[model samples]
Target chain A: MRRLSPPPTSKLVIFVVIAFFLLWWVPFSHVLPEGFPLRFGTYRTFQGSMIAMWAIVALGLNILTGYNGQISLGHSAFVAIGGYTAAILMVDYGWPFWTTIIIGGLIAGGIGFLIGVPALRLTGPYLAIATLGLALATPQILKKYDGLTHGTQGINVRPEVPASPDFIEDWFGIKLSNDEWIYFLALFIALLMLVLALNIVRSRVGRAFVAIRDSEIAAQAMGISVPRYKIIAFGISAFYGGIAGGTYAQVVGYVSPESFNFLLSINFLTTIVVGGLASILGSVLGATGLIVVPELPGIVSFIPGAGLPDELSWAFYGAALILVMIFAPYGLAGLFHRLVRVGPARVAGVLTPVQGAWLSWRERRRAPPASPGQTGAGSEDRSSGDQPGTE
Target chain B: MEEFWQQVVTGIATGSVYGLLALAIVLIYRSTSVLNFAQGEMAMLTTFVAWSILQWGEYWVMFPLVLVIAAGMGAFIERVIIRPVEGAPVLNIIIVTLGMFAILNNVATWRWGGIPKGFPAPPEIEVTGIRFMGEGALDIGPTVVSYHDLTILVFAVAIMVALYVFFQYTPLGLAMRATAQNPVASRLMGIRVGRMLTVGWALSATVGAVAGLLIAPLILLQPPMMMGVLLFAFAAAVLGGLDSPVGAVVGGLIIGVSENLVGTYTPKEWLGPDMKLTVTLLIIVVVLLIRPTGIFGRRAMRRV
Candidate 1:
């Protein structure tokens, strides 16, 4: 049977580019005249930037947890490192914002390398617990070392945050607000990192990371240096985390001990898992879902008789999480793939009866009835395991 | 010198609480290999139920009822939330638990509100005219231990021994152990593998309830009350070796004592009480560095 092949890579790239541009445009579009279509609030633009920033962290975390099979509950520590570094360099030493972000990433990556050496001795839940210890201690360490961290009050980076450059005003005939400027900066960084992640996962080093994740002894036999690649994965992942943290500093315009708490680390892990592990698309989807899903109740409240209390929002998020795990175990990415594979008509069969009937009637008329053997094969594929494709 | 002894004693009391929760963690990990991140929240929810029950009933009377409710909740969760993804990767199950963590914490906060409420400890009892458990301090050697602290210690040891006997001498316990060791073989041997797992969860939830009940009196009942304890308990469980109950308790004791000692003995200018948690965690990390499987955990062997 002939399989419907995926869209050409060039087409996929163009699609992504268009989608990303729209993501940037829609939120910032609120600056348009009152009657403009799809215009959103500045707050939405800020939220969109947050999504971009979180996606960067998710991409980094997926490299370690999804690709390399090392669980870390201490990523918040790395983020804190990056955030504090940027905050300190900008506030105290008066460094340029861009340079500080890069330096923050580099420092975080260096520390990640040091931590990864010890991490090599651990695996599975043990490694998770050890790293959790790091997360649990980070706040206290930050608070205690007030000389660097600015203690509990936290450092405000609002004054240090960069405004939109004059070049954009001259060239595009548009003046960007600070929020809009920051959003663009974050989106640019996120896109660059996303491209980097895509390449890294396809490279020889990425193969080694995957090989080791599948089996350490086998990877070793295959001539992959297990410790070295694991450490490198840690460094790369931390660098991404640091970059995201720096972005976070700019987006939120503050750096505090409480800002990079253990819950944030746990959320990062949750983002990757729910987005679809090991898939670059999954990371971005997960980040978007993490930021946007919680606000869904508020968004839906505009609908008549559909209002939900804000108190129940977290409970809704929790239920959504569990449902996602139960129904779409490979996360949103896997669900997307499944939908693409099975087509709308087949999916409709699982929906409401009236809709299913209408769709099936249309489907039957539009195309010949599928061969018996082909449909059977498709159902079998649906029942297969939850492991997301490494690609 | 007296201060050192006092810190050690105080540490033991708090450590007992950590150990109790860690024991609950180990029971589930032993059977299902899932680290229940929601353990503390489960306990917290039950303790809240106990608080609500106490409004209409006595403390001891509410205790057993709360345990039963906790057990039922545990079984329901395992069957409903956990059973479908039972064979998924460890990370997926952990995520499920994290989801449960959010749900339980949110529900408890929404239902009870976030205010700290006074939870009563087990009241003083007379066993053969010897007073046990009351509101007072007992002078022991160099330390003055609170009655509540002693009560926690007593309850911790009792639960440990009871669990030991239950797992050692009982046929059901043996079956559960068999299930943990090799579920397929246990199934072939006519053991109800699924039932054993459900029971393991029930047992764990019950143990967790006891920990929550005991700790609540000291810390005051609140939604986020158990978050800190849960982290320490996780540390204890990992430190003790996830599969070993005894290890959990010992690890808790070690962590508790060291935490207190570090806070008390460290320099006031730089590494005093404020830095105690950081220091303790550093020490735990160092220990983990030396023994990756933890001090008591058996090294896992896998075939390629």
Candidate 2:
């Protein structure tokens, strides 16, 4: 039997070191000399901040959809709540930015809990539609109550967005631009949330989530309060969404009803699935990919004599999404893990067993045919204990 | 009282269009268990095809051709894009449909440009010299309804009846129904399950195309025109029941009527016309709270 374990310690250390270096370098890379090859633009820093904000929501969504097997097309509402909370606190009540993030998170989590109680009855597509209702209603609710949300015109927080403290300039000998400062702020919060997500997925609470997802009855039999854990999952996920929402306000310095539309929720679901569901790293990778993939045409156009029209950018994005789903069903992180495990030489052997596992698992749940018993038995042997389906 | 009746009449006309699209969505969901988010986009694309055909051909001539083309496109998509990920996780299939949505919408915008085109309704058909559909309104008791809205309602009813007949009486429909109920059993019984699925897509696309054709004249033809209707239709499908065809149509009618009524009758201060959509969706959520499987959906039995 093959035992799955982390990569060798030396390789892990190198990976961590490189990741840390990139995170540390991104905010300051804009400061590099104009002609330097390593120099990145202020725009890239801003994009990085957006990616960080998006990743926070992706992390929360993955916990619900990926780990807990609860699909939410309504996360935009939670994010909106968090964002509005932050914006209202900062702009209306004169609250500091950092404290507002926590408040936003708490408020969002509370509402998530309320939604979850009702959601306990729904499963699969039904649950998905129920949450989708939340997403659909968010903008209307935001617009109808102009007194609170500032209506369709949206709220601007640019003046309230905090500038970098003078201590940073004195201590680090680096004077950061507004975009760079925002990027660092978002990145720091993302890192903190990422660590918390990692811990949550590894702890006892996380195990309950996975078990409940696998089989609710089985989880209940194992003394896991299914509803409690499921609701808790929603709360935690919404808290993360709220935190990201607060981060969005800090980063974008604006909030509007239109910003939290249905498409945003759909994109969040796409991010987790495309990133690799049930993965912390996949969430980050997906958020980065979501931001970067649309820019691919622009990036490719830089090549001499090779260009894709800007109008076709969305078409290209759609094609990329399809190709990725067909070829790399487990997502970019899954592809990355597979490469790391097998190395480049054995890459061709990637699709067989895992795909077989999913197919056979589905078949087994349906009425098993007696004719293909041999192949079915063979497939079941490899997939019995470790299927990745949400059955 | 007159205004209330008028809203109801108008609501039924619009709701029928919603029902038509929702019926298409339900058709795919029932047969393949995959919610085609791209259903509206598929319809929109076929309507564009119809618009192009109309440039040279007559209205009646373009109609059947567009349906055939739409059916073929649906089957082609099922075979090429959907086949590979057939047995994967549900989320994977959903994402693929969304991908298709993006692709179709973008391609249509790219091909046709974003300008809203004037797509004529099924041109004034003079059946028995009575003028069935044309640029005129008919008074029925307390309310006057436009010929286009009446045409939409008629098309919707005709399609529903045809579908009911197909599913109940035809051999091909039986095989498709069997395939939907139990693919493994249907395969063991020598039904070509794959062929049935392809046919299902073809049938669903035909229904959706009818919806697009009927609605384009009301909302004008554009790439993004179906975005709002698609959401409403999705809500309609869920409201009626994902698997029940009748439920989808009934759900659509209910939503349509309630939306209009809510807009007209609700208190104007905080929850009036602007809040109608929110109220309608809230009603759906409330209904779902009572019936998780939808109003007409069968409760799925689990063997835990």
Candidate 3:
């Protein structure tokens, strides 16, 4: 069936170029033509960059949870570590932002590797429980080391590449804020990480990760070095999370213990699940949902005692998650991929109720009608076990 | 040394609450093999229900009503939200629970503002009194254990023993165990798998509500009150082994005591009560590293 098969490579290239230009407009949104919506300028760009940061984290989570099947609810711990590391280095020693980012990612990866060692023996739920402890403790641990973490006041990183004030004359002869500069920084890194993640997942190591996920014993028997691969996957996933953290620090110019809480980790997990686990594009879509869906509460503001947006957003978000999981466990990316694989024919047949009924009627008229409730051969046998109580 | 003894007793008390919550967690895990992350929030919401009922000043009525409310809510959640995704991957189940956690917490806050409320102290606390605990306190040098702490320890132990008897001696308990062990076989054996599962959830939630009720007096009654307790209880479950009730209780006691001791001994210049959560995390890591399946949990055998 036709899927409006992704436009030709050339068209795709043009589309990407156009998108880049549009992104470039985000920082200077305040100066755009009158009556343009989403003209919050720096705020919009900041929010957009936040989506990118979340995408990076979600991509990392997808590798560990979606692909490797090792659940780490404490991913926020890795991210917090990375963010704190970068912020401290930048604030204290005045290290370059890029250096801090690399160092932070490595440090977080090292921690993840250490965690993965013990995680080797833990199954799905158990691993999650362990990580849950880690996530919950992270903020306190950071606060405990007040000498480094500044005791919850947190550290603010000075942007090494702060936008210069040049009267709109030196750079682009147009007034653009530092937010745009940071957005590109995050976007560029996100794209690079996306490519790297895709390459890693498609490579031989990726297959080993998948193998261990399906069955560690089988993977070990196949000589895949299950423990080594598990540790490596965990490290790589943490690396992405740390990178996102560093990116977040650079974008926000601040690092606080409260920023990377268990709720954040839950959001990352929700992103992966809602976007489509194990799919590259799922990360981006999930990130978008994370940022956009909360505004949904605005629609129901008319309800009495609805409270503020932040107060009620989580309820709606949770409801959305439950509904989505119940109906589309494979997430949006999987649904799209399947639709493409099945082509448009089956999809079209499922829709257009009139045609479906007419076709069935025609077939019924051409042949004798089958006995009611005994039509299908597979339906001849029903499990003797009682059905689940619907009430 | 006296301070240490007092802290140990206090830890036992706090640990008992954690133990109760951990028991609920273990029960749910036993039945469904999935961690109910929302267990704490569900309990918190119900505790609020009890709080509201108590506001009407019907103490005895509140107890049974709260249990019934919690049981109904638990059964409803299992039958509706959880049943559909029973065969899905563990991660999906985790996500659902996380969602429930968020939903329940936010809904609770919306219904009853985020401000801290003073939980009406149970009359039993005053009736039994701190004097009884003082008499039971083993006087070690200058440190005398507080009766409040002693009461908590005794309360937790009593509940654990009661649960033990219920699980070991009751036919329904045996059926529940059978269902947990093998759902298909249990179904074929004329045991209702769905009913057992719903019952497991209901019982677990009810237990968690009791934990919440007990904990509320210790902490402030607020929408976010149970978040930290839940994490600690989760740690206790892991340390004790996720599938073992006794393990949960022991793990809770150990964690609670250690938490108090660490907070007291750790230097203010270095670490404080703020960092006590790290101790729980360290225990989980150490236990997982040493025993993997937890000291009490049965080691899982994998088939390829």
RMSD of each: 3.2, 5.2, 6.3
User: Which 10-residue window in model 1 chain A sums to the lowest lDDT?
Assistant: A1-10
Provide all candidates' interface root-mean-square deviations.
Answer: 1.0, 0.9, 1.8
Which residue pairs collide in model 3, if any?
A1-A344, B133-B147
Please report how far candidate 3 places residue A69 from its true position, in Å: 1.4
Candidate 1 or 2, higher DockQ?
A: 1
Off by over 4 Å in 3: A1-28, A158-161, A164-175, A299-311, A339-391, B125-151
Instruction: Write down the TM-score for model 1.
Output: 0.94
Evaluated against the true structure, the overall lDDT of model 1 is 0.87
List residue ranges in candidate 1 displaced over 4 A. A1-14, A17-21, A35-38, A348-378, A383-386
lDDT of each: 0.87, 0.87, 0.78
Best by DockQ: 1
Ten residues in sequence with the least summed lDDT for candidate 3 chain A: A382-391
Candidate 2 lDDT tens digits, A1-391:
2213342233352354248536746644757777887566777777888888999999999999999999999999999999999999999999999999999999999999988898999888888887888998899999999998899999998899999889889999988888888878898898888878877887899888999999999999999999999999999999999999999999999999999999999999999999888877778878988999999999999898886898888888888888888877888767666556545433455556676566446655654345344355334333332233221
Instruction: List model 2's recovered fraction of native interface contacts, to 2 decimals.
Output: 0.70
